[model samples]
Target: MEKLIDDEGEIYNSISPKVAPVAVQNEMEPSNISIVTTNGTADNNIGKSKTTISLPSAAKFTNAAQKKAPWLKSLFQDECSAWETTKCGLAELIGTAVLVFLGCMGCVGSMGTPPSSLQVSFAWGIVVMIVAQSIGHISGAHINPAVTVGAVVMGKKSLTGACVYFVAQCLGAILGYGLLKVVTPSDLLLASSTSPAETFCITDLHGKIPVIQGLLGEIIATAVLMFMLCAMWDERNANNTDSGVIKCGLTIAALCMGLGPYTGCSLNPARSLAPAIWNNYWNHHWIFWFGPIGGSLLASVLYRSVFSLPQCSLPECQSLNTQKAELYKMMYGHGDMWDTFLSGMAELVGTGLLIFLGCGGCIGSLGVSPSHLQITLTFGLAVMIVIQCFGHISHAHVNPAITVGSVVLGIKSISEAAVYIIAQILGGILGYGLLKLCTPTGFLSSGGPEAASTFCVTMISPQVSNVQGLMVETMATMVLMLIACAVWDIRNASNTDSTSIRFGLGVTCLATIFGPYTGCSMNPARSFAPAIWNNSWLGHWVYWFGPIAGAAISASLYRIVFGLKTHDKETLTPISESIHLNSVDTDKSEVIINSWIQYRVHLTTRVLTLGKLIRIRAPYTRKKVLNPCDKFSHTIARYKSQNTTFYIPISLRCFSRMNLITDLLMRFEEFQNQVYRVRVSCKHLKHVKQSKHDQRSKAKVHNNISKV
Candidate 1:
């Protein structure tokens, strides 16, 4: 008789009276069993019998089980459902309908003497904000076809999904307008002599605006909108979504106010299409479609290719060592040369665009000068738009002063700062040259002979001396640098959703307060450009010297007062020591393990309570002998019950031996600090106990000597 044992610990006995004793030998494969039997004699009637059985491997059985039931496999998969996509599309449809209905109702002239541009702009902006906030999570609230197109170009949406979104948006828009028509009076829908259109909100060129100028206006305005959307969608700005809807609404309002006079600011093709279909007004309608679509494609592609930051995998992002290495590389200026080149180009283009748009807004013809408020809003919004477009790529330091401040703060190396400064200066000159080429002669010379040395030149007023002008510029630049430093501070990293808006409004505030004194030229590059182009360098040194001094001082002060210190040594030492202590005794091992368990319990409780730490003081129990696998599994189940995610090392999860558990726990860094602290305390207690025992023994020996 022979016995065979299986992996499950079940034994099987084989008996055959006619056969000789059977011999069983273990094979290299655990699943393979071999049995051999020989006859009692060569001439005997009984013959030898050999039987071999091969059992299925556990892995093979598991794979077969998984394949047999696909639903079981899908339980662990993270794939999105078809219903989720349908929900998104439905949300888009409803969001678009709401936007159009509210926006067009606000534009209805029949309600009164016709609302002012500012009123209509605010209405539309508020409506957009409301709709976005309501449905943003469900479908991203892409009420505009241009936004959908931009998402497609950025690879954020599939082609089929985008097509569905477009169709839904169109239908929603049409439905919204139809509902408006149903509610409004019939005479209100008719065209008046002043309107000359059957529809209420048909977008068309105003005054004597040429078709090409209107087209270009629409394209530029829509491009700005798309750029802001792209910035909001970027992964680096993932945490900045709290006020994203408000930003979008304000951006739309600003675009409309700035460009409404020329092109009606129809940045959305669907918004324009709905009204055209209602009133059958198609004159120059192609501008609305081609302009927005073209601009969306252009801006989306540019942002994705040039301004988007590289994203790391989850493992890399979670690794402290990798983060530290990258930080060190950046601080030491050892980053990729190609990235540096791209950053330089971004700075160049960003500065050039700033100068062109900002200075262009300053142009006034004849007696029609732009109002102070207009100038303020223009420069502020221009700053916001430029930053939104290029901030992720190069930090959007369009000024030499900001570059200098960055160098002082250790955010940029000397070489990188030099590259940025050169780019800014060159960009400024190029931008001014372009502005001069485009502006009419009298417009560039708007401020009369004395004040019209050149448009947008940073010159001191008659009441303010060169010294006063320098002080004003210095103070203003200092404030701006302080804002930059705050934005770059680690404490405020998660609160960058409205950075561009904050900067824009800050510029507006400073300019409004100090414009009459020195034109509020806090940027040396901005002042240098007009001075260079106009060949007018009166008190130009003040602009350069004041901003640089202000930047250096502000950067130094911010670093001294507000910088967060990194404790790399303190954070890394415990982990290293724990990893080295692999041969601890059973008592020390138990101490370490118990300490780790306590730490985990505390951590889990704190997380579950949303930062409220809960204290648990339970004595260690040894009623049952549990292996590491059981302990780990129990801990994991407890964590899951509290809705906390805990990851145990795979090796530790299957550990069957105490020594194996100790070895793996020594290498585990999560609870290493607490474990090491407990271990040291245990050793100290042991030393104290040994000293007490020795003292007692010495006292006893002395007592025996006296008694004798």
Candidate 2:
């Protein structure tokens, strides 16, 4: 890629047609132009170069685009299309597996008769930070079945992939846990008293928590989970999608770790089912599943309909390679705006599973405090792990309001954000439903009022003034939202900011500090879910309205007074660029200029962002386009001692879109032309002489697969 006049240019590559229907060389007309794929002397490249004038000069393009032109339509056959559902589907399956195995395992394995709730909670938190970094690259890490369903509905994935993702998640859970059983210490398992009831129950209190009380506890907790899922990490922010999941972990852990002592937090059905199956308890499982699911639906619908703006405008045709590079394509292959929403919906549903586990642990009969630190730890850890496990696919909002807020803030595109919200609600319902099936009343006669207290959303008796509680809650939420906005900001999220993930840990710290008061009901949607199910709607308005208002205020303040900005929103600063791809559709809408090439790309990037890589392809023959990374590399590589080789796979076409390919013989800072790449990697003879160390000849021969 080269910037021609007016900061625009062209790049040239010497290569043979790949997957060509006709012999490319045979079809060349009298006026022929083909790059020589080999290293040539400076004289060979420039000394005898014929810089002659031509009769018909047009913009330089690859053979793939030529096929799309109507004039040459009959000259070629169709090229392979890699941006198919099958690819995204496979990604989703693997992503879901990663999330479930790690997240759920953290919840079950960490709980025991003697354990620290705070430590357990961090387990989940750590999982979110680690797994997201790894799994995000695969299928967008939709690890949660619910998230997969949502993204599919949002048009991020084909329906086929979403279905496959759910199945994959369930199977993965069984397999992951089965493996854990083999590796887990026998003594640790013997003392493990972890359960939904035990984790949330207070040891001093005794008796069954009325259904209404238990239900209300779940509602607010799940609502808090949902709101964070929606508002904190939407890619619409200036950051990465995982940012929202990261916030969810912190917020949920706050409730589970600190508030679990009051009421059981059964926010997910899968959590309930897993423990119930393990413990053989089946009582009032319906409340757990139905309440949270219903609450999730209500919040999703309310958020979508009441408070939001239109989302990003989505183009119909998205290149697969481009999507992969931009997002974490863990198990679920990546998708564009439409598909991303679908993925978010899958996250919402998967969150239901999380609630089932965390909340169920709180409600599990044996979960009473002092002796049950392990239960509290299990609850918090569950959240941490799930966020890590499912951060990629669907943005893992897991809550409708977070998705809604993303839209309101112009983070999400209008294309399919609704699907994600809906899927989350449905998934929540299913999660709770499964919980109901697993827990029958007779199973937990041991759990007393103390246990019931753990799941209750009660306020601490600070004996403080009304203003104090309001101020405390307000300020806490403000700080949380501010951090969330910062993390979600695309500019920051897309860049290297380990600090954002730490913010999530910070929220957990806040819970550790403020757990005694206000119950940290940071989200109203959480309160809403269980309240409706258990007929515990008392003071529900406080949980719902208070946090939202606080969040809104914080958002406005951050966006206005503080001048913080999200990626797709009104931003505070703009970086200059040395080169940019002026993407335009051809008259036929078939020519897509996409590829990764070495070129002179002149752009001022505040930071390197893989998401910004340009892609240009007509039919096939893709290349990696230039973005900030190229500029940074040129600037940084000069001081480095070792020479590194870089390779881009042609299969991921979109990733190469708008790639600024440079001249093969001459190194450059930023500039591109069609004459470049005339002699790259076409002819590499592996003639290695006897040496003490392995020669680099073999590596050069496989340049296409190597990276510098």
Candidate 3:
């Protein structure tokens, strides 16, 4: 026996080790048996027996799960063993810390003479890109509890892993905030605190928007946030790339800018919780937790059900070259190490630019805050600019939430994610440093840093309550994510080219409408950065929990119901199978027939040559030498040892029509050997009859002579 076995114990190929020619066995049962050849003689030895042989059965092989199911065993371990639990947790920790630090710093400057919403939005957008680039390779840089939960639901992370990451992220956020406190002066820190007077301690929504309205805003915002994340990560979607990161960041910033005045969009629980812990302002904290969690869960369910990758086994889901660069295809299409480095560098530069331009815009306003329109334009336009510049490089994610979303959806590897996040954080720090370098020392001393911090975070108006602020953040972030999803979804052909424009405009719309109520933070990193710098943790939960929840819900809506349908649905049919051949027109029959004849003739020649070789080599055969001329004719077809030729004559065109000759060939195919024999017999019948008559006459004369 010969068997080919794969690394696993499964036998895939089988071949008989040896073959013997012998008589058929009497004991074996046969059904519908055809007699191909037989030899019979009048004299027979009755007592003799023909040779008999038996064939061995094929061998069977099975995996080593005889006593237990393989699926059960797999529960304790992954199908693949390369995943490192500790490394993933560490990445999550580092990534979260980076995001919180930069975002908090942005808020730190916002506390005194706060920059306009436009400036704040732009600054936060840059922060998102910086963190995403710095840490996107490791642990997916979720930096948010809601994003972690969404990852679990998306099947990217195990339940145990999710729990570990959540803890790491929360701790990382705290550590990041602590770093800010260490650097800023105690007096300046007080100015950065998240108080009812200066932070997201909402006491009213311009006296028109109620508490429920604020909550609705958060839900909607967070829904959009999650939806966009899923859309950007959808491989079935063409626009799922680094550019999606920029689009997402820009859109998210716009949401915050627009909704900032209403409820200060705190779309992430970690972002919100860190500052709240530092400041001990726990009022209406439950809203932040519930709103974001609910929204994220909803998004997860929707994305999985509607737009998720077709259900497939783990072994079949791996791609050989997933990291191929889409933006710089000529340089990085092969996905070499150089390409990886270049991608990371792109992220670094892009993130640095995001921070520099965003913060620079705010710091250069010369003391007076710009109007709402100017602020919105500054932020929205900055986002558009970065997207245009770096959209092709690292995708400029700038936001940890989107990175996590990509990982959960399997759009990126964990290692790559870590690199992106690390780069993002460094870029953010550099951007802030640049801002400080460019500003006058006197301005820096006169609440410049504090005001800059204010621009980085979300703060509720005095009239809005904590619950209302949480709701506002959640809804605002959700709406932002939803739009991001739409912009990135390639299925929506009309919006593909104008993604940045659409996203910028959307952010402008959100900021213009909701800037006064909660500050429309719509991002945890943006809100947390300032809170930590100013030591103002009040209502921080609203930023983290709300935005994260919003992201989750948005992922669900766009992936499932809102997203455009793809070109084709997944199916089990083989790629090579012919489905439409039957639908071809009769007019093309000539082409089909001609193609068939060429194929069959080639196959027939090979078969005939093999048979001839076998016969010539047979030792038992007693045959006369064949003449050279007869040999050629015999190779084609033979009847009663007569020289024969079977061919379509080219010179007989006048008598036989081309169509008729082709029709005859077609008939011969259906009837096979019988048709050929009949045709030959008909052509030579007269000659054969005459020759037989002469032989009979001669035999009669010879018999009479012998009798005489």
Candidate 4:
């Protein structure tokens, strides 16, 4: 008998009567297989036998080993294909080249009639849109180095990729301008009647426009551009991409039109660098680079940290989102200190921006003073921009009057209101100080031969009395407060799409109508800043008293007449019955319970869980317990009639582990509250109408009796 074992651990037996076993021939390589043969006699009755076994080859064994470990193979693979990276770089290069070539070509006067500012602005805007649409899928169409930096900061692009894009963009800009120079006539490229000498498309400050002011203008313009980009890139806005290209184009055009006179609105360093290199004109070139890059960095970080939606994958991001939500609830729904510091900071920065931009636009440069219309529009648009940028963070209450109004409406506590006012005043002062630093001494104040008034100071007309000026300020502020009330009304919550624009136009109208009388100083902080800066205190008391008085009166009246009544008398009556959980699923039970509580109660409800016990609480009362593991079938629900706690028990397995149900319940409650507010407003309006009708009837009867 003989026994043979193979590599698979299977044994085979062969028996022979002969003394010696048959020999086997091997044809494979020695290293490929290992074989052992042995012959022995177990007993006198058994004959000699041989055993043989086969082993796997070295190559096969190595392959099998590699299959067991995948990371080893992945370690050697490239992160991105070289060809794909090259293609992306090339796309950025070409896109940037196209942008420069087309954008500058429009500014060439020799091609045709000299293009107006409007034409030039629209040309750049349209070219940007065209390039974005063409190469947006490839390399994200980052034609500007500033945009590339922003992308890197946002983690949308790797550092190495950003470096590649930056180099490509710069080279493309140079190539594009070089090509333009070749095609355009020498007269147009050089000094000519239409084009300034050594300027071409090179961005520069207007005559008498201080370098600091120019720098500031470029920074502000680029920041706005970056803000728009961040908004477009937000995950929450993922579904709103159809009109992104158009909106971007229009935004650029608007910026150019607004800031072109001051700094040429060179929001792209690459775009400005191209013309400067072509013309060999480097005056204030650093401003273009530093301003755009700094602004892009600032805006990108701000949006990511404060404004953008949180990514749940990151713990810090989730925490940030929670803090922001809590802050919002504290400000609008309830009171808390979750993020009051951040809110105050936002108010401070927002107020500073409002003052700086609004007052900066008032300064006259060179020999040309801004028109009344320009000043009016400037202040209006400044307010609009500030509000749009900081509204989510702090409600952009850049005005003391607005803060005061919030206090009267119970949206802010007295302490919170005080903090906001102090921040606003300090921010205004700081903004004016920065403005004075940038402005030329001659342009800092009014009283040149052109009869320009003090820079942004609200002055009463010499012909009008202080009392009359006070009335003008008071009435203007009253109108402004009324607008705020309408915006804050719960009934108008869904109609906030164009709120910034509406406020802008409203300010413009007020300034246009009442500007000559009292400068329409509807904001005390706005008026106080320039007065402090210029030391012009004539009729200053009127500004402070008028706006504050107007805000308080308007807010109080609006709250009583049009606002939601949150007192016990107006609270919705809760259901006074028992809720039985019989054969309902977890989700359905939750929905039914939430609906019952939300529709019946007037308070905001919150649900919390600890182990197997669930606690439900309203902002106005203590917590109520619900045992999820208990066998109880029914519980009394008396929250509607009185503010007290109650208990209910049900199976815990029916509830979801996720917070999705809780979010849905909260949203449902908010919707119900909005509906309730609408109903209350309608009822009040009906009562007023009926009272007027009865009074009219009584007056007619009295008149008839007197005639008889």
Candidate number achieving the greatest TM-score relative to the actual structure: 1
Q: Choose 2 or 4, whichever is better by lDDT.
A: 4
Error of 1 at 46 (Å): 56
TM-score result, candidate 1: 0.62
What tens digits encode model 2's per-residue C-alpha lDDT throughout 1-708? 121222222223333433121112211112222222212101111222333211111112222222223322322322323464455445544544454455555545434334445545555555555554565655555554433433432334454555655665555544544454466653344324543433321111123455665665565456545544543333333244535445545545555563353334545544444444544555666666665655555544444433222322121112222232242221123336445554655566556655565455545353443324433443344445444434444445554445545665556665555676566656655655544444444422225453332343434335744455566666666666676677676567555323435543555555555545665545443444455445555445555455556666777776777666665422222111111111212111111111223211111111123433222212111133332334433322111101212222211322233222221101121212321232111111011112212545556656856663
Please rank every candidate by TM-score, starting with the best.
Answer: 1, 4, 2, 3
TM-scores for candidates 1 onward, in order: 0.62, 0.42, 0.41, 0.60
Q: Supply the global lDDT for candidate 1.
A: 0.64
Stretches of candidate 1 off by over 4 Å are 1-82, 108-117, 182-194, 197-200, 206-208, 309-334, 356-371, 429-459, 530-542, 560-708
Task: Say what the RMSD of model 3 is.
Answer: 24.5
lDDT of 1 by residue, 152-251 (tens): 7776676667777899899889888888888888677532326654747888875456787677768767877888889778765566678788778876
TM-score of 4: 0.60
Error of 3 at 35 (Å): 27
lDDT, model 2, position 464: 47
**Candidate topping lDDT:** 1
Cα lDDT of candidate 4 equals 0.63
Question: Which lDDT tens digits does candidate 4 get at residues 589-708?
Answer: 221121110111222112223343343322122333332333343222222212445443322222322322223233323222222111111223335458789999999999999999
Which of the two candidates, 1 or 3, achieves a greater lDDT against the reference? 1
With candidate 2 superimposed using the best TM-score fit, by how many Å does residue 103's alpha carbon deviate from the native? 18
lDDT of 3 by residue, 51-123 (tens): 1111111111111112223332433443323467677777777777777676666655435664445665566
The alpha-carbon deviation from the true structure for residue 434 of candidate 1, after best TM-score superposition, in angstroms, is 6.2
Model 2: per-residue Cα lDDT at residue 655: 23
